[model samples]
Target: MTATQDSVSSLQTSVPPALSLGVVALSVADLGRSLDYYRQVIGLEVLEQDTHRVVLGAGGEPLLDLHGQPGAATSVAAHTGLYHLAILLPGRADLGRFAAHLIREQLPVQGASDHHVSEAIYLEDPDGHGIEVYADRSPESWAWQGGQVKMDTRAADIGSIVASAGQDTAWRGVPAGTVMGHVHLKVADLAASRAFYEELLGLDVVADFSAHGALFVSQGGYHHHFGLNVWQSRGGQPAQVGEARLLSASVFLPEAELAALRARLLEAGHPLPATGDTFTVTDPSGNLLRFGRKV
Candidate 1:
């Protein structure tokens, strides 16, 4: 096989073309603290907020919803729950601006990596929720082999990325094109998580890092729309109801695809609890997913 064909050979490269990830809802113990962190540190503007709930976004898009739970405890480590929510900037320069802002503000960064397809910086919220800010390289340059997209974790060139921020680079806030790109979750088992997201939800396993106990799935040949990892929560129970953690992740689909997904869930014996025009279901590891049409 030629070099390009060889790279594509081992990939499970089929994904439904009509799905897009939407807002992720989180439950937090102190709404005010979490709200401030996202606004000042993460550079999101508040779109809507009330005593109990706050919606934050950039350029009029809603990316996160925070619900206030006055006395809720922190999410336990031994739980099938969130690993992180990745915020995708439109370009590498935007990532540089954000990184420079973080450094100037003296915010703590957990780590960073060059995932081959993208560069990402990691941090934790006041509630211990993981957050990843990243920018994708051109798809033409992505590497693929062994039935999966190539991914590796190495120290990101932080100095170089930060240096990209010139006076022209403004850190007003998340730019208009910023988006909640993908979500990573801790799952009890990789096999079951793969079946749930791939067979049931129709995502393609673009990358599988079994050696690292993680898998990435996506649609339309993007690097990943969701990441499932067993690093921290292997063999863990799902978060209990009323826990201060991830609540539900929303996905928008065309009407036809929405109906087709409903049928698949029914055939799999999973309940589709509907409310108005939206329906929700719990995944194999108990994370809630909400699906609706893009009307």
Candidate 2:
């Protein structure tokens, strides 16, 4: 076995199966414009709003929080930061309805792909933050071999997805069950990221694409909660202060697990500022993450 595989097998702690992602916060160039795009194009409803910030989601659940910084620098492709924030639909029909909505609205889609385990459609916000809308096949349908779940990128069957919409093709909004599925990041170094997320944070390495400069980690046999890659950001710097970029992504875990993770972070010299019921830390590649007890 490769040394990396050995390291993955040796991980001692696994996060609880109930671990889940919460709201993803972003810094955007214009609050109003970003708000409109998210609501109209992405189909999220505003949960709360003010002059400088807006919280949006579906069916009363807050999924995204946008903070506006007037004249903020636009995010560029070379930065080591958010590659995309994935939103998972609860069913294939929901994905089909969303796909049809994009076509009906004439929105520019970045790409669509079938990753064996899920089918996804990609888009970019007004400020260039990447977004992914997807739906998974049943977990039992996934194929695993040699301790790794097999996944790949290929052309999505858009026609079939749209056909799945059946007679109810009208786009209302994202359904109640939509959620923040996973976050993909462009890191400066794969090995360093692996050490931070896999070894230090205690996420299990579900798939390691070291040859392609990418890695996937998760808990409880899910495909991935985090996708780390160096594709465009190899040796790149963090997003500058004014750049429209990911501000923070929140992870929810059991209180006991959170305490254990805090201990791990403290032992590794990562700072944990005092925060009630939650704490924030910066990863090795400068990504901000907030941890909280799952309620």
Model 2 earns a TM-score of: 0.95
TM-score of each model, paired residue for residue: 0.93, 0.95
How accurate locally, in lDDT, is each candidate?
Answer: 0.86, 0.90
Instruction: Give lDDT tens digits, candidate 2, residues 22-65.
Output: 99999999899998899999999999998899999999999999
lDDT of 1 by residue, 184-255 (tens): 999999999999999888888888786789999887667789999999888999876667899999988888
- Show where candidate 1 strays beyond 4 Å: 1-15, 273-276
lDDT of 1 at 119: 95
